[model samples]
Target: MSFGIFQVPPPANEPVKSYAPGSPEKQALKAAIADMRSRTVDIPMYIGGEKIYTDKKHRLAPPHDHRHTLGYFSVGDKGHVEQAINAALGAKEMWAAMPWEHRAAIFLKAADLIAGPYRAKLNAATMLGQSKNVFQAEIDSACEIIDFLRFNVHFMQEIYRQQVASAPGIWNRLEHRPLEGFIFAVTPFNFTAIAGNLPTAPAMMGNTIVWKPAFTQIYSANVLMEVFREAGVPDGVINLIYVDGPEAGEVVFKHPDFAGLHFTGSTGVFRHLWQTIGNNLPIYKSYPRIVGETGGKDFVVAHKSADAKAVATALVRGAFEYQGQKCSAASRAYIPSNLWEEVKNYMIADLESMRMGGTEDFRNFINAVIDEKAFDKIAGYIEQAKKDAGVELVWGGNCDKSVGYFIQPTILKVEDNQYRTMVEEIFGPVLTVYVYQPELFEEVLELTDQTSPYALTGSIFAQDRYAIELASRKLQNAAGNFYINDKPTGAVVGQQPFGGARASGTNDKAGAIYNLLRWVSTRTIKETFVPPTDYRYPFMAEE
Candidate 1:
């Protein structure tokens, strides 16, 4: 490979195919899904390039059709977790010592693999494993994963180019060194792009990783591992494991060499992990780095002058896509009373028009939620809203888990901004609406800011520039990913760096240099060109 020292091509959002009727991409996806459904794969724990199988085999099934077996994965215990950790440590020296250019090359190849050869299979796996429809699967598993891989290379090059200033007699330079120990990356089932990014980001910067993906996301994660191996990521550099969270934590966190954590999961789990690390802080060789992106109760707000149809579309797409599992999905909305009637009409029509069913059919706009637990949790909230006099059901509020876990896209109309549904992070196809007096726009903005502890993402729709400007200024720290005249979900890689402050996460801003910086530590080097034999200062010489 003739790789040259160069700047990366500017990143642009990956074009999304409509996957409309009779489209080639659509056909390809259907074929892929059918192909995956026809066979049951045997997945093994990958430690140091070794495929370790276990007697504790767990069957894999689609969330949309839980009765059918798609595959089986070997479940690991504490011993396997320890083996993964040891493997990561074993590969650390050579992987970290390799030239930066070589590291960049490997990931770059992986991106190409995802974009070209592995595209349909990975997308199909996401649909079957996570219950996402075709379009949702395309954006996440195919496009977003490619974006992360390519953009990370650019970010890595950018990080390397940063040099320190030099004084008159000496040249000063700074080295961005990878952290000394292995990273424990715990990813969620929501996004396959995140599953690939969390561990690969650190490895791209010369760090080793013990990656434990959510059991639900493992089908696609296994595909990602294949891409990585084909791209020449060395043995033991990024060991993939399938172990229980607490069991793995018992071994990894207590180990003396655990250097960092890359996590994107529930806030409760992140907090517990943080506390565990704190309690075991003295056992490690150094303070372990904790970079986590937890839960979010994101929102959307509309001004009185906003277009009703546009606002309605944003709500439908933002709150219902992937069944509102996105961390940046709009869960709550504050609408002006003047526009509520028209907006509500459009929203209801859209919900009524949407089709919900299995992922094998591309025409269905809505698919089942991840599993039975998610279905029950969401159904409980909908049932509460139906029973409560204070809340009115605007549209769908039904759930059935007989064949698959299906929760209808539900809308709850609330008079108060402080309603429990408005403040809580319900990762489901649920949207709560609070219509405020147009005159109380300022108050509503304040209420929206105070409604949730999370500040991940939010949107504002307004034809009035002054109102838009006001909300932007008034709700400054309210959201890390803020949108204007757009839905809050679907943050692009390079354009809208994703993360949040407060309870949402560390706000390191993934998809940019900020996130990559977290994986590295800095060292300053000063080279004196002409060493003075005497260490005396000018004043001392004069004396």
Candidate 2:
């Protein structure tokens, strides 16, 4: 599959002249290609409050067009991971001792830095490394990070100010305090927001953190470190390492000083880490906190009275945004039989209008997938779906790896709910459509529940208020973040807390006060105005 769309120009050393007004073709071309420049920077494993250059180098390539080399990043082994853990442990004492007000200031400063000088570069890297289009990359790399930082700063201040009341006759005061240990934050590659969460939440609550970012996003990750440093964050307060999975996990799980593990990834990996910690429980000094957000098979339901245009727009954006890599992206949709044809026509027409090309092309509605492995995995699923009985590929199953990992935006119609395509989480630009009679709405809901092991996010569209409310309550267990008249992707910072229940891992909602609470272990400090005169209390002395 080839597209003849206008290509985005390479980064220019000087600004180009804008097209004259009333030139439609010129304006269209300009709109189709975003004016963006890629900045080259050396990537290093950050440990012990410093960036460490290593002998091992991994060349970073843009997924949109593999010809563009983002930069060379240093790969860390077990030794580097250990250094990061040590740094985090070393910083724990002072960081935990710092006043909450001071820590909050540092985070606020970091937010400012990210929004200022680092904004453009981080946004560019996101576009280059992750194949996100201009607007999408900006949201993930710039907007989301700034929002998270601001939210964290505000939440920490609230946590700091919370107080306990004392009775009128009481002569003692109670205070809540910070935890005295290190946190291990393991983030994923899908969303740059995860990058912010892994460190900021812990730092907000006065806990030092050792962060191991996904290797696929080393450039943006390094930029994140630079932002933190510029914000006057103390040395060794947050340590970052760029390494492969197994070696990094081993270091994190085996460290004697490890206090908590904050993770977002696969269920298999989460279970493995849980078991690893359990196996080593006998030798550990104290119980370590484990928090995770894993896989999802999020769904959408369209009722008979649903607006066809609204449903189509929601479904297309939800399933194809960021190439459907988000855990909360809708993978399944149930449409009532009466509205099935209209919904299908509207969805197909909208998808046809979607332009697929490189990230630099502003007109490109969808970019490439992350890497070849993901490309192959999605391809295999598509091929398997085609071969299944009564499964029809409505839009796409095309793959072109000559340039990068690009898969066509795909839509499938599954005749039976029992089909594997309808059941599993296809974390790609693929949507499985299931048609159901109005009478079977309840049965369809049950099928949805049983089909997906994941319960991360789901949505319903209906004109009937009672039906919508009933569906919401009935499918309450279906999603940690449920939606009505909106897509599941693009969760706002303070509005909707994100995460899932069951096999989707812990429901630790990111970007909220609840998430910040997970990073710290609270200690209640009680002080008496008058010291006890004797060893025993007055009541005990009378006895």
Candidate 3:
């Protein structure tokens, strides 16, 4: 129904609002949080464009205030997974055949809605439900998700314009067709933006989706669904379900029409799902596209020439923000001994100055982990580090879960480079540092690269150009999103196309055209103005 040759205007990154003191956004967000906390809402599974409730209900509570029940989301089983898949398939034809402009418009409208009317509520939801500070919620749930939606629409337009050159007298056309079946979007609890992007990215490319967000994130996830529906995404185009992982996998992986997976989670879980999909390959109609962004043991390495204060700031902000749950968070560091004292002083001072509490209090820079399981897991790591003779807990080793799941921003100074906390993905506010002799910077680079199987995100802090260049080249394969003189986290949508390889999932570069390309199966069509008298006779005759 697009009558004109449409051009989606190029998009700008959504401006991040600073919920500054006495600012309107801050006031609105606070009011929204208060309003949400005042009542308990019942959330239902959205399957086939309908709200489906079930007997099994899981309580939704803020990690920082676990006793106060915010809501309960109806849980589904294998049956709901099947229904979601059916609904996705049922809507596939119309959605795939929809005019490209209209498809683009829906998501663009969604972006605008988030930036405008839904901004405060969504941010409030993220802060309460995911235990993110106001700043974290602003950057993630509001700005990042809005950026993803708008930027993805622009990227989709760019993908459609790419075509192969044609020979003289032949008209060659390439159509980026949607995958033959539905996409399974398994998202994590860490980022609300990721939960939104995983399903909507594939759906923007005309593929229907069965999206299953983490149970801990469902409270904010429901707000995103409302935005999607209000933005004019047709019923059944994207189905939201709440079910056990194995239950969903059992149904989705075995389905003949399951065509792709967009995932963000743990490496072990991704591996298991991949194996299951491979085992059920014979049952699928087409080879499924498995795209994922998984775990990271991300690093930060410092040279002797690096500014000690700058390095310390990067560490404190990069590793501690959102409790270091981000895939790109700096979990390990290789600090040269020349500047260790200065860096340690700065970090210790910063840690002492910080306060921790519920998200409603803006003064709390640190908040609770997502749940009790996460609290226990992180505490286990801290406990092990305390026991390990090779590592010393230098600062902030407090763990108090009596009220909420809170673990102090813990740091381990390690003698062993290959220490467990240094190599493993803790997925919490735990950063491990190993001080290397200044002269062995190159050897330390190799050590940093080899110590972890992950190549997700890593930063090099060096003032000397030679040292910076050397580290950059030597550790080129160490990180997919490499940072020089800065922290490794905060990869923006349009600027930094984020993802990593090796055990860190596929380096698909989620916000770029490359990620969108995965959802499309291209078809080449060549038309000739005149019929040939003989079937490709020139090569045969010459031979």
- In terms of TM-score, which candidate is strongest? 3
> Whole-model lDDT, candidate 2?
0.78
Which runs of model 3 end up more than 4 angstroms from their true locations?
Answer: 534-543
Work out the TM-score per prediction: 0.98, 0.91, 0.98
Query: Native-vs-model 3 lDDT?
Result: 0.94
What is the TM-score of candidate 1? 0.98
Model 2: lowest-lDDT 10 consecutive positions = 8-17
Per-residue lDDT of candidate 2, residues 1-543 (tens digit):
224322212211111222245554234433423332344457877787577999888888777787767678888889888888778778778777776667767877776676665666666667777888766766677777777877777776666566677655454343444455678888888777688778778877878888888878776787788888888888888888778888887877776777788899888899999999888776556688888999999899987778888888899999999899989988899999888888889888988888998876667889999888888899999988888889988888898889888999899998887777667777789999998898888787777777888889999988888778878888999899899988888887777778889999889888788887777666566556566677976677653
Please, what are the lDDT tens digits per residue for candidate 1 over residues 1-543?
436666766656677778888888878888988899999999998999899899999888988789999999999999999899999999999998888888988998998898888888899999999989888999999999899988999899999899978899999999999898899999999999999999999999999999999999999999999999999999999999999999999999999999999999999999999999999999999898899999899888999999999999999999999999999988999998899999999999999899999988888899988877888888888998898878999888989898999999999998767888998888999999999889999898998898789989999999999999999998889999999999999988998999998898899988989999999999999999999998877886653
Summed over model 3, clashes come to: 0
